[model samples]
Structure formats: C-alpha cells, structure tokens
Target: MELRQMRYFVGVAEELHFGRAAERLYISTPTLSQQIKQLEREVGTTLLIRHSRGVELTPAGQVFLARARETIQAAGLALKDTRRAAGLDEPVLRLGLLNGVPGWLPAALEQLAADRYPSSTVTLAAGTTVDQVRMLSSGEIDLGLVRTPLTLPVATTSEHLADEELGVLLAATHPLAERTELTLDDLAGLELIWIQRAAAPEFYDDALKRLGDQIRLSDISMSHSQLHSALRVRRGAISLGSCRAATPDVVWRPITGRPLVAKYAAIWRTDSHNPVLRSMTVSPGLTAVRQQVVAD
Candidate 1:
C-alpha cells in the first residue's frame, strides 16, 4: 500500500525473521511487525506464516515481495535520472551552426569551452539556418548559430553574435582582383554570380536589386566550384561571401558605398529547461565590439 510498507515487507521476506529484519532496517520489531500487518490487511492476503523455528513467506507474500523490490529499484533509478537532468550530473550541450562557418570558430569554441566547463560536453550540428531553427524549436538542440536575415521567424531569444561584411571572391587573374576595393558602380553590368536561394532569400534578393539592375545567377547549388569557375574567365564576375570564405587563393575585396552585410547570431528557446543552453548567452570570452572589429 505504501513504500515504507513495501520496504518493510521486503526486509522481512529477505531475513525471514522479524527480529533480524527490524535490526537490519534500523526499526523496532513491534513497529516493523505492525507495518507488515497493515500491509497484509490492505492487500487482503496474509504475507507471512509464523512457525516455532523461524518465519517463512506465504505464496501471496513471495509474489508481492518480488514486485515490491522491482518497484523500489525502478523508482530509485528514476529519481537519479531526474536529478541528473536538473544539472546535478554532467550535462551535454547541443550546439547547431549554419553551413559555411569559419574553420576557426569551432576551434575557438572548443578551446574556450574546454578551459571553462571541463566537465560538460559539446555536440555540434552543422546545417542551414532553416534546419537549425527547426531543430531548436523542436527541442532537438540547446543552442543554434544562424545566419542573419533569418528565413523563419522563431519565438526564441536571439542575439547578434557577429557580423561579417559581404566580400567579392575572385580568381587571381580577374580584373577586379587588382583593385583595392569595389563599389556598386564597379559591379554594374557584370555577369555576377551569387547564392541563388538561401534561408534568407529576401535579404539577398533585395540587396542585389539595389546593388545592380543587371545581375546574373548560376544554376549551381551550394558548391565552391561554381563560383570559382564563374570568376575564372569573366572579367567582372563575382560571388558574395563572408570574409572567412576569402582564402589565400581568392582575393577578398569588400564592397564599398553599399549597405550590404551578412550577420550571424546565436538563438535559444526561452522555455527550455537546459541550463547549458542558458550558458551560451553569458559571455564565453567573446564580445560584440570584438566581433565588429573582426568583421571590419
């Protein structure tokens, strides 16, 4: 009927003697016997048979004892798991990132996390902003790093983590690569290549509309080769990407006299019970001013 009653029953069933069982359980023999009697009455079945030599379990008592022991063990395990989820034990931090992240970002995060939270584990998921947001909304992940001009509107707390000015990537011999910087007029009348469809379609399309009236798109998916080949032959061809994408092989020329910029932010669900999710908002050795300076 009650957990205390079940425990007493099990102790008695194991010891087979009221005196020994009471001593093992640190209770008085009379109290233990009274609780066992209460349990038998609640069950409407006699649990123990008292003989002159020693006590023995009845048929009903044996079956009930097995079930009671099982229930007690299961309850204990459940309590342990609940407490661990409450951050009493080591917790895992699930982090999601959009595609085309800098190669250095993960390294930076790992170094910082290792030095700070040595006991916690971090799992990384890389995908599109749309995919990351969907996973975050569904409670699949704790934190997400998404590109700005978000495709989907999320009901979560989002902060601008960093910004990288859009740069034009060109081959070594391209005519525009010789220039220190480019402007809207420099990109005019050029066979421009860019990300055709992304999570933030409106932002890309609207920015392109203002940059030049004559913009051309390629039928290439998210591939580096398409942009590389496009810039190989065409004199004015260019592809837009963050400064991180600007490698040594390709020249990274920032677009001047333009209001174009790509921003990235960290988002997390406000209702999540994960404490590791909340830690991401707290400064992990990063600052908004430093991010701006790097983007510059």
Candidate 2:
C-alpha cells in the first residue's frame, strides 16, 4: 500500500528471518513484523510462513518482492531524470542554419567542437532568417545562423558571424556567363528569378533597389534548388546567391564594386543558458559582436 511497506516486505522476503531483516533495515524486530503484517492484511494474502528453522516465503510473497525491487529502481531513475532536466546535466545545443550559409560557418562550428564544449552535441536545422527568428522566439532552437537586416522578436538577440559577397547565378550558356565579373548594367533587361520577399524581406528589398527597374524581376518565388533548376533550364534568367554556393551547372560571378553583401549573424534567445552557445558567440572565426540592429 505504501513505499515504506514495500521496502519492509522486500527486506523480510530477501532475508527470510524477522531478526535479520530488522537488523538490515536498522529497525526493531517487533516494528518490522508489525508492518509486514499490516502489508499482508492490506494485500489480503499470506506473504510469509514461519517455520521452527528460519522462515520461507509464500508464492504470493515472491511475486510481490520482484515488483517491489523494480519499483524502487524505477523511483531512483525518475529522480535522476528530473535532476538532468533541471540543467543539472550536459546540455544539447539546437542550432538552426539558413539556406546558403557560407562555407566557413561549418568550419567555425568544427572549431567550436574541438576548442570548447567537446562534450556538447550540436544539431543543425535548415531555415530562413524569418523561420530562424520564429523558432528562437518559440524556444524550438537554441541558436541560428541567419541573414541580417530583419525584424527579430523582442526576446531574441543576434551577433555577426560572417559576411559574403553576393554573386549572380546564370546559365552556363548565357552570354554574360563568359565574363569573369558582372555589373548591374550587364544584367539589365534580363529576367530575374527572385526568392519570396517574406523569406528575407530586407535582403530582397535591397536587391530590388540595387538592380533598379531596368531588370525584369519575376514574381514567382523559388527555393535554392528550384532556382538552380530554373537557371539551368531557362534562358536569359539569373538569380542571386552566395558566391560559395555550389552550382557546377551555372556560373557564379561576383558583382562589380561589391554593391551587395550578404551578412550573417548568430541569433538566439536572450534567456538561453546553454554554455556552449556562450562560447560559440565569441569564437574568433565567427567574429562575435555585441547584439545590435544590423544596418543594410
């Protein structure tokens, strides 16, 4: 009926002698015998048979003893789990990655794993800047590598990770693809494949402003893979992406004068207590900076 009763019964069942069980439990023999009788009455079964030699357990007592041992072990495990959940154990770092992350970002993460927090594990999820911000606000992820120039939730903070030059993705057969570098003037009058503004409004708007009205911007939105397919199949169409993006089927040429740069930052909730995140936010290759609004 009670945990104490189960423990008392288990001690008697294992020792098979009232005096020995009482000694093991550090209790008087009379008290132990009384509690065992109370437990037997509650269960409505005879647990032990007294013999002139020592003692022996009834069949019912053997079954109850097995269950009692299991219950004690389970209780101990439950306590351990509760303590670990309360931040008393090693922490898992959930990291979010936006599409088109610079190649150096992974290297930075590897360095973090080697130089610090070797015991912590990192998980990577793919998302856009907007998606990362929402995940961070909801506590779904601990950290995010996201693009700059966007509105973040009130409780979220961000740090600069790296900056990459924007490059144009054009078909291999396109005339401009032959050039080592491209300018907005060269891309003029060409149809552009654009990602949805909702994905990264600030970056999309900035690209629109720099490209000007001369370029015929398409309204359809496409992801990285879809945009790659469109560039390969469509003619006189181009899209913008990181220069580090691997597109063997297309030419990735840098823009002249570096008019556009894609900035990346590590976004996280201000309340996050993951020690690994603290170490990563200040790592050398990541170029950590104070939490601030990134300017376009």
Candidate 3:
C-alpha cells in the first residue's frame, strides 16, 4: 500500500478510536474511516472490528499494524535523509563508533573541522561494527568508525583508518602480568575470553584462527565493561584486545613475534552528501595516525 495508507493505519491502530485517530492525524473522522476501509479492501481482509464505543483489531489487523508501523518509520527516515542530503536540514553529523576507537580519532575530527565544514556539529554513537553498519544503512548515522574485514552494504563505502596491534589484557596479579611482552606460545595454557562472533564476524574469525588451537577458550558473553570486571577478578584468564584499549586495573602487553592486529575503517553511505564525511575520510590526520601506528 501507500505510505499515507500506512500512516493512517498506524494512527488508527494506536488510538483504536476513529474520532481520536482523525484528530491526531489532523483529518476528519469520515475521511479516516474511508481511508481505513480502502486499506482493508487493498489487503483483502478485515483489519479492524468497528463498534459504537471503540475499535478492536482483528488478527489480520494486528499483523498489518506491525508492518504498517515499520513502513511509516522507514518512510520517515528516507524523507529525513533526503532532506539532509539536499541541504534542507541543519548541519549535524551523526557519527557511529565501534568500541575502543583509536586515540587519534578526536584529533582527526578537530583537523576536519579546522580544514572543512567548520559549522558542522558532530554527535557520536557507540556500538559494535555490526551495529554501526546497521545504523549507517538505516540513516541513523552519517558515518561510522568500524573494525575492518566487514562487508559493506551496496549503498555504503569504506576507507582504511588504522591498524592496531593485538595485546593481552590480564589481571594485575596474573603470572604473565610481570612480562613486558608476550608471545603466542606464552598464551597457550591461559584461558581466553571470547567475544561474540556476530558482533564482528571477520574479527571474530581471525581471533579464532589466531588463538583457538593454542589457548583454552572460555565462551562468556559480556560487554566491554563486564569483560574488564571479569579480568580484574579472574586471575588466569586473559583476553585479546587492541593495545589502545588498556585500562588502569589490567596489564596490557603487546604480543611479541607473529603479531596479531585489528584493523579499523571509516564507513559511510555512498548517497550521503555530508561534506564533513568527505573531509573526515580524507583527513591528513588519519594518514599521520596510520603512519604512527605502523611506526610503533
């Protein structure tokens, strides 16, 4: 059906009263009723049971209501994106960031502001790579900093940001905590804390390939904070994370020979006309940060 039909259905479904729905939609009750009837005809099934007092949704109505709400939300987002692209909206850049973004991202953003789009304001949202990618696709965010080895959607593009060496996060009291550096062989007998694969499939797979056969794996589902808490309490347990993710209570030591690295990329929609996005993507600061990481 049409977007207008979906909006009308959602209004009526939520209100359950023709008069109230019409009032909410800024239309007359007769018009709302006529549109609902048209929607029912198009669906070839009864959606609502009319009564003198109020309305009740039929089983088909319940299903249609859910889909109709989704359609309306999607349409609203599409319209907003279009307006923003056409420069009809305020210059606000919504940026999505995966956990543990590198230390240089803020500097890069500052460089972007000074060099281009000085009037633009940026808001940041934190999520995993998968969540960031989904947000980018749905027009919830204009740009994303996500872990690499991800497959971008057809409408999106990405550029390499930086690559960070994987480091061991261990309890302060652990035996290996005294070492300045660790090797893959040193991690063989330790219990490894595993991150969920669905969060970043490529990173997960690479982690498994690197440690699955050598280390004793512990599959515990936890967020970044929870993982840090677990590390503080569990003596022999360790996790592989970016060197830049070091916290005060844990010992973060770079892996020695055969280094493991996590790559990051800046992702954005191809259709976005946000000039700030282009500036962020091509910032010299990012290139300098990449070079510094490589030098380290």
Judging by lDDT against the true structure, name the best candidate.
Answer: 3
Please tell me which predicted candidate would have the highest TM-score against the true structure: 3
- Candidate 2: Cα lDDT at 41: 97
Report the poorest 10 consecutive residues by lDDT, candidate 3. Answer: 106-115
Q: Backbone collision count in every prediction? A: 0, 0, 0
Please, what are the lDDT tens digits per residue for candidate 1 over residues 1-296?
88888999999999999999999999999999999999999999898998776699999989998999888866755765688777674556777866776655555555445555676788887776777787787556677777666655556877665656777787767777889898877776666676546655655666676677755665543443356566665545678876666656678888887757767776778776665544544673435323644664
Where model 3 places Cα greater than 4 Å from the true spot, the runs are 1-87, 279-296
Residue 272 in candidate 2 has what lDDT? 66
- Give candidates' CA RMSD values in order: 19.2, 18.5, 8.4
What TM-score does candidate 2 reach? 0.65
Greater-TM-score candidate between 1 and 3: 3
Candidate 2's displacement at residue 205, Å, is: 1.1
Lowest lDDT 10-mer window, candidate 1? 284-293
TM-score, cand. 3: 0.68
Give me the runs in candidate 1 sitting further than 4 Å from their true place: 1-90, 106-116, 151-154, 219-226, 233-236, 282-296
Ranking 2 against 3 by lDDT, winner: 3
lDDT per model vs. reference: 0.71, 0.77, 0.79
The local lDDT score (0 to 100) that residue 25 gets in candidate 1 is: 99
Task: Report the lDDT tens digits of candidate 2 across residue range 38-124.
Answer: 999999999899887667889998888889988876675576457767868555677887876765575466456546677788777
